[model samples]
Target: MDLRDERELEVTRRKLHVLEARYEASRREPDENAHVHELSLRSLKRMINQLKEEIARFELQTLRK
Candidate 1:
C-alpha cells in the first residue's frame, strides 16, 4: 500500500483500539451505578460496531485499487 493508505489504516486502527478500551472499561462498572453504566456501555458497544464496519469498508476499498 502507499503512504496515504498506510496512514489512514493506522488512524483507523488507533480509533478502534480506543473504542475497545472504552468498552472494556464500561464492562467493568459496579452495581451502584447500574442504570448509567448500562447506558454508557450500550453506547460504547454501538460505536465499536460502527468502527468495525468502517474498517471493513476501508480495507475492501483499498483492495479494489
Candidate 2:
C-alpha cells in the first residue's frame, strides 16, 4: 500500500479503537445510575456497529482498487 493508503488505514484503525473503548466503558456500571448506564451502553453499541460497517466498506473499496 502507498503512504496515503497507510494513513487512511491508520485513521480507520484509530476510529475503531475509539469505538471499542467507548463500548467497554459503557459496559461498566456505578451506583445510582443504572438507567443512565443502560442508555449509554446501548448508544455506544450502536456507534460501534456503525463504525464496523464503515471499516468493512473501506476494506471493500481498498480491495477493489
Top-scoring candidate (lDDT): 1
Model 2, poorest ten-residue lDDT window?
A: 1-10
Candidate 2 structure quality by residue, lDDT tens digits, 1-65: 22246567778678779878877865764637888878888887887777677667777877889
lDDT of 2 at 55: 68
lDDT of 1 by residue, 18-60 (tens): 9899788768757687898888888888887877787787778
How much is the lDDT of residue 18 in candidate 1?
Answer: 95
Candidate 2 ranges with C-alpha deviation above 4 Å? 1-6
lDDT of 2 at 62: 79
